[model samples]
Target: MDKRFIEEQDVIFNAKPDAVPYNYRISYKVAQVCLILAKSCWGKSGCLPIKLHMISFALCSKEAMDKLLIFTQSEYAEVPIVRFDPAVNSAVTFGIADGLIFQGQNGKYALTDKGRFFVSKIEKESTVLSAEKKDLSLLSTKLTDAKIKQLSDIWRNIYAED
Candidate 1:
């Protein structure tokens, strides 16, 4: 092995644990999933398929929020572009493990009573996820399950393009 390779390995091995990026942190993703469930799913019966969760999380970005707003205002005249995020699976799993989220018989995810209480705490803070809170509240229950299904089909078509 080259001397440089050994030095790089030493550096990596000796490095201390760094802080995880906010997006990748389990707690952050869990909170995001819970907030999405509370705002988007609760009104419709407190559950949404994993696809909806992925799409909803994708919309959390400021750019995606703009797209979502346009879609909502235009009455879905055109399908807005949305991308699937696999990272949401990890978050959902963590939520399930912690008893903050549950899967229904239909394989949809919903907030548990514990999850609702956690969300209440998040809501009362008025600081955590403040921008996301505003955005999600504006979108509460607007993207129905049927609409989400349509959106997924549209997304599939978009990705299928050569």
Candidate 2:
């Protein structure tokens, strides 16, 4: 159509994209994982299966919680399907690379000393992640690996049958 308009469109297409938002940044996600581990781990071990981490992270979202609450009260009586966010793996990898966390042979992730210190800082702030901290605290150790796996199996079975 118009030559100048085509050139302008090309420039727009080549422009650099905006930076990832603070909530999606790896450092911020690492902090979120560490806080989750600190609050939700069953014992002093401060370790959790990766799948459970996904669940806990999903629970941090108000939307996810609302859907879960409604699902629990519904008559279908089926296992709730959780949406797994793949971005969490990057945060976990960054934590391991930075020595903030470690993955065990048992496939569980536990915070290192440095990670604990980082989480302590986040905790002391009281303003950052306040809502997530409160939600995770209320859900401490309630979402176990076994329970997650059971739900996953049910989901797979239902989908597989269809």
Candidate 3:
């Protein structure tokens, strides 16, 4: 994995709840993309360009891209990813500007100060509680009960259909 990409994921994994919902959502998705790109780029010469980044990230689901465009439009009023090129595969051709993610000409996305603070707080909390350690015991019990009830309802429905 690319060192920078791993660092970026660490930053995201630690993201705080107080962040603007839109920004947080975008940052998280982008960070995930970076991790995948970085893994693919390991020991390779050239880094994957923005177009490839979009393709790599959007491959699993356009849901990520759709949410990103919505966030960018609402937050920065920018529509960088609007263009679609036919020459490349439809999946890979969608391009967005770097400015929407990175502030300067670093050619890579870095979190803003607010983004950093939010991530730091979240990371700290995550370390303290850990997902498994956190108390969701009650919720888990309720969820199991709900699932059982739903299955029972489905069984009744199947018999009624006959």
Candidate 4:
């Protein structure tokens, strides 16, 4: 019922109709990163310096961090969620979690003004798209009860196979 669902549905339909389910996962993951960045920006000069170990602990895996970083970067490279490698002297980019640790002395990672701006953009777009989907669902009302049940059964079976 959330607005993000609408946007996610729209994204699925337009960008990758064949992978509707994946849209849900992608939206949830992006939202999670937004929340994490928001929380980290709560104090200080809107910056939070977090260690890679802490991020790994929080997310439960380095792979998750990697995926999240990739997703964030792909979606918003200009206002990226994380910095690249900080531990080494070289300039290697890592996930946001890893970047937090490497940021300059006060290098803690915080959402840039632009990053905060995008949070609302993402949320709003998601909500609008989801709302439109709900509107489309109304078309199903014309279906017979039996047809609805059959479709439901088919979906259930398809999902159960996994």
Tell me, by lDDT, which candidate is best: 1
User: How do the candidates rank by lDDT, highest first?
Assistant: 1, 2, 4, 3
Estimate, for each residue in 1-162, the C-alpha lDDT of model 4 and write its tens digit: 322322322322235556555323444333334434444334334333332222312243344444434433343322212332233122113223333222335655445454455445554565633432232233212222333244345557866776
lDDT of each: 0.68, 0.63, 0.34, 0.36
* Model 3 C-alpha lDDT per residue in residues 7-92, reported as the tens digit of each score: 43344334556746432244444433333223222222323344334333333334544543343235333232322223222211
- Positional deviation of residue 18's Cα in model 3 after best superposition, in angstroms: 3.9
- Give the TM-scores of the predictions, in the order they appear: 0.75, 0.72, 0.25, 0.29
State the lDDT of candidate 1 residue by residue for 1-162, as single tens digits: 221101211211122277666766666677888888888887426566544554455556877776666665665566665555555778788788878889887778888887777787778767777887888888776677666667667777877776
Cα RMSD of all models vs. native, in order, equals 10.2, 11.4, 18.0, 19.9
Model 4 lDDT on a 0 to 1 scale: 0.36
Off by over 4 Å in 2: 1-19, 44-53, 56-60, 66-78
Local error of candidate 2 at 123, Å? 0.6
Error of 2 at 87 (Å): 1.7
Candidate 2, residues 1-162, lDDT tens digits: the string is: 221101211211122267766666665677777777777764445465545445555666776655444443453444555655556777788778877788877667888877777777777767767887887776666656655556667778877765
Candidate 1 ranges beyond 4 A from true positions: 1-19, 54-60, 75-78, 155-162
Span of ten consecutive residues with least summed lDDT in model 3: 91-100
Please give the lDDT score at residue 121 for candidate 3: 44
